[model samples]
Target: MRRVLFAARSAVALHRLLDVVPVFAGDARIARCFTLVPGSDFGVDALAVVDALGGRVVPWEEACAGAYDLVVSASPKGELALLSGPHVLLPHGAGFSKTIRAEGSADSASGLDPVYLRRAPIALHAMAHPDQVARLRAAGTGAASRARVVGDPTLDRLLASRPLRDRYRAALGTGSRRLLVLTSTWGPESLLHRRPDLPAELAAELPYDEYQLALVVHPNEHSRLGAYDLAERLAPAFDAGLVLAAPREEWAAVLVAADALVTDHGSTALYFAGSAADDRPVVGVGSGGPELIPGSPMDELLRSVPVLGRGQEIRRALDAYRPGAARHAAEAAFAFPGRALERLRAELYGLLGLTPAAATSPRLLPSPAPARRMPAAFDVHAGLIPDGVRVARHPVGLAPAGHHLAVEYGAAGEQVTLSAGVLYRRPLPSGAGWTSGGWTRHALDSYPGCRTAGVVQPCGDGVLRFRGRELPYAVRIEARVEADGRVSAVDPAVAVSAAHVWVAGHRDWDGGRVVFNCLVGEREFRVRLREATEGEAGAAV
Candidate 1:
């Protein structure tokens, strides 16, 4: 059996390897193994990815000693010269759009820099675009002779996952709301670094029901700073209702789910432009001003896309995404659109002198819901409209307190929120439901300010009980969002939230009936919250 060594130096590299590993399924002739290498300071974090992938890891020393037929690494970093094999170096990112300072050279296009390129006996340089090779050749990099256009497997997977956009959104807990993603690459020039407060600000600024906000931080950042530290830095955003993408498997999925993107000149903005969000709203800030390679794909992306200036109203700039915006530049950065796996598999088999089999098919990556912690408390704005109530929620700790407050049962009880108007829990077991009244009584008893308490039943509907002489009202939610004349479904929280507002101020008593406007998933129905008739006791009319 021919041995293959997958050298991983960073999370980015490991993700690239993951893109192609499925191509070798059921190949009994090849034994695949992985070795974590060093390039960035975050090389140690690659071990976590290795563990997560169940990548059969050989120690660096053991990997160096072994003779392999083909060695693949997304980066040519960390002692590639010592590994005995026809080394294939793939660009972990969208081509060579970054600027790197190597030993001796001041700054060069990252992957093409001759100082790093010619240092190893690299058998192949996997170019995403033909222009990468041109840049490499122009720089007089002797290794350019071995460069080949194998396309971008990362982009291929992203593009392929476009059909699953709705599924991606559903996994992330996004119902009918438009998903707004804030993406950043690592380093000082990243969007998060420059505008650390943006997540909280935007989360506060947007109505929770109308829009869903998510943060996609680079894995390298999570690596550079430990998980705890990263968590500390983003805790405010979390408290303010910003859904954070998990370290792996989520960033790309978020991109796939994004309806609008707010980003720096990082690769994500470029990826968003090329992928599902090709025509979606993309609001950019030029943190890469004079930093990125001028006229490069990354630069062209920032140039072509609209720039959101400092102190500019963020909402208005959302429409800044022009039609066919950055699509050309993104296309230029990637050569073959959806065939990276095919071209790459052929290239690897050729290097091993083995005929590549076409039986194995590449699978589109599944985007599981990111295990995110939703805010425990929300500052609500419940406005009485004509025969209905429009409720918007912003997680607490973001902006100043408004009129109404809602608290979940599991939250650490707040002294100031001891008098909260709305107290609720969702999907509670049938025994502990509002009708059963153990936890609800305790919750209302603990908070004297709360006049009503509620709990969502397993059926996605809820029951709200009043403190005084009122029967428990059954809560039902309907999603009324439509696209192409087709309505969408909403999360249970939407109906529960609006119901919280109704009881928060006893709006149902003053008004005849209220239509709870919210989403349930993707289907549309205008839900009515009405008082129970004498014939139908405790039933919401």
Candidate 2:
């Protein structure tokens, strides 16, 4: 019997694949399955099916125990390390389908081969188009020799499943009629999240009450201020008829049930296209490129599909490109149930010299041994800053008890010294230089005391006097380094403002030899100081 190992990180993708893979493989059973189960209410339909088919389920770290004839992985991140045997890479078809490869760079395609192509005596299969296969071959080693174009297995589920249009409508509280499911795919870096003018764009269009709107939220979004959250928050203002679906996965029925679709540049759009076909009026909102899969002939099929830059345009296109009697096109477009498992089995059988009957029967694939934990007692090293740098003290004032004083040095030789003290009344110049006239001193004996004095004698670098003590000081200096090699002070700050402040100090990254500016404020003041390095200023004299 062929020992097959299937590993996936996402329960959603696994369940979706399991929905149809069993039908194609005949009695083929899962030998071992490894998955991550984050404690979320999201159901694992795929794991359920695997158990029903007699597959052993285990934790993800258990995959390395025994040799396997075949391995299937859905995680792109873990695939490279898991390529000991013939492997099928099923990257969960999400944002990856629409990822634009950088120009003249095959990083994405080549990155896939570390687990598939270079592992000798193994085969690679892609659930993408022939063009994708060609691209992978062009970009990856041994890919030209091994890669094959098998359609996505997840698409097969939609194709094989009966259309629950009425059932979905009833669940959504909408009557049996045409519905538009707007799947939200918001990105953190996109302008859609930061711009203020987006509400008008969505509001000007999609005002139809007859078209029931279901807003599907992305899973990664954390808060309402975020792009996905903002879309959800703004969705109600644009259309009171809109329904927001949170904790995603609830929209799986919606994807298969909706008559029309709207999406951003995400994999859900590809799933809809790959599964639904070009039958329904699918609109690509806020997309700059072609409406179909890049580097694929599917673009020809999606030529008539509208790619809208604005919400008004999307609405107009939706109204104009209504599905013309192609309501049932989704089923036909994504029809390849059990194809993924069959392909997986064929590849495994070819590599391991096993028949379908033998491979499909129950067999024990050894469990991966538990990881060896390191001993708690290990050699540890700790060091302290050298003595030489003088830590400056903050001036006392009627501030909070925990409030501390800090000195911030900026680039361009500027400095901001902040401390709580009684506002001294002195007519000071208030210019660049500090003078006795600028400040009106109001002295009240406070718990924490403050003192300042200067005694100058050197024109260049030499011994200078401060409060009767002789110390190394400089006038009109660019930077100040103490005897311990730590920063003593910096002159002339750059980009200093009431809201933002910059300070210069001796940084560790530059061999502890160069000065770098860092931000200083209420947030950064709490950081504790350690020992000083050589050449840093010693105690303030």
Candidate 3:
């Protein structure tokens, strides 16, 4: 028997590998260890999953020292330096949603790292779609020659078990009610993190008497907000009659029961697009602006399906959603449905120089339905600006990590107003002074409380006014934004010299944008600013 180790760095990683591990466990010719990478953070979901997998845990150092015959990882990060065996890279999720990585950087999961592509000796890369292989090759990942399409084993299992939808619906006590599933992936750019009122807004717009709403949040969000804490934060929506599914429940079953889906751009949307049996309407909620991968599955879905803006009403979006185009796109994206697990098993076994065991009995994998109406669990990474206004100084186009001026704000029952402008930084002639670096472009969001690409609102003489709206009491300007330039936070002078923003009329800096944080009765408001010298003003590139 050959020894194989499945190493993971986070709970999200474990979810990705869940489809493959069980098949390996059923085999007699393979010895497997499902363990964590030493020194990596483990979310509550990951811990719960690890416990359920018979606690086959080992430290990264210990596993590498064990002389495992082969090692399988989501990415080549962590203590991979300790491993001496042949390696395989099975991505934890699908899509090229993240920003492009530097040639040799191991900072992201897209697997475009130069070392992994060029010299780290990756033996095989099992991809979810053939398009991914082309994408990898385009990105110059070293393993193009070794890439193979194995479909997605998770989707395979879920699609094959479509009958479970009835059970899931029953378990949720949603008899005869059309279930609307809302999924938001974790990150500052995620829908709920920026627009905390999305659930309430959506639920309110969707007739409660006609349809039932269920929310499926990302595990990273649960880790950022403790499971219980996240659940508490979303309690208002739950109380308003939204069904919060349990984290441990198979997302497949939840999707199975959904009559329609409203989601952001993430793995959840990718999988849902492929596995929805009824070919139901998939309503995409755009980040306040256009930030989707053009021609990718997400873009395809948006083009074919009905898409709503960040703060748009649900009923209106749904009325325009068409299901035919989505079905066609799904067929193209996931070609070998229902055979993914079998294909994955064959490929991995071949890589290990062993014959896979004979096929098991013909029956759906055992996926139990979760209990009815669980509390919502929210998650987001820390250091994210939460429901507030933030200001950070950097070169005209650079954002320094961990250096932000953020303030949380809320109103009870009144509307808040916001507007903002930028001051560019540039070097002056003859060493006399540094002034404006380039044209001042003011940023605008289509909606008030979500992270979307900043729409460049043309301005005159370094002044621009964003359209304002009166929102419900709990709104905030929580978008992922920054100035464009490189400058260190440690150097106060350099930071001060960088381009920045102010709330138009106020002397105080209010970020690239400004917000009026108040309820109908409150007199108080907040703004974020970074000090700058007089010479830095009117700096045009």
lDDT of each: 0.72, 0.39, 0.54
Give one digit per residue, the lDDT tens place, for model 3 in 1-541. Answer: 8888887777777777766675574678787777777554444457568777686777656886787777887765566657778877787665544433432453433455555555456788888778878877876765778988877776776677787777777676554346888888766667687667787666545433236788887767766676577658876666545776555445667777788888877657767777776667778776423334466665566567776764446667777876576666665556577777677778778878887776632235454344444211111111213333232222111122223221111111112112112111222334323122211122123224321111111121222122242110111221222245321111111111111122222435333333432110111123222222233333332
Stretches of candidate 2 exceeding 4 Å from the true structure: 1-3, 10-29, 36-57, 82-84, 94-97, 100-122, 186-209, 217-250, 288-304, 309-314, 322-541
Q: Which candidate tops TM-score?
A: 1
Model 2, 1-541: lDDT tens digits are 4566665444544544453244225545435454443332332444554576686776554555556666665544433354356665554553233332432233343224344345434366554444555555665566556666555555544444425544555566554235677765435422244333443344233322123555555443423244355555565333333455532234555666677776555455555655553467776555424322443322332344566555556557776664532233222223243265456556645666655564331111111122211111101111112211111111112112222222221111111122321111112234333222111111112212212111111121111111112232211222334466643222111111110111112222222222222222111111112212223223221
Q: So what's the TM-score on candidate 1? A: 0.88
* Residue 11 local lDDT, model 1: 77
Over 4 Å off, model 3: 39-45, 100-109, 113-119, 288-292, 310-312, 360-370, 373-541
lDDT of 3 at 91: 72
What clash count goes with each model? 10, 44, 21
Give per-residue lDDT, candidate 2, residue 319: 60
> What TM-score would each prediction reach against the true structure?
0.88, 0.49, 0.64
- RMSD in Å for candidate 3, one decimal? 21.3
lDDT of 1: 0.72
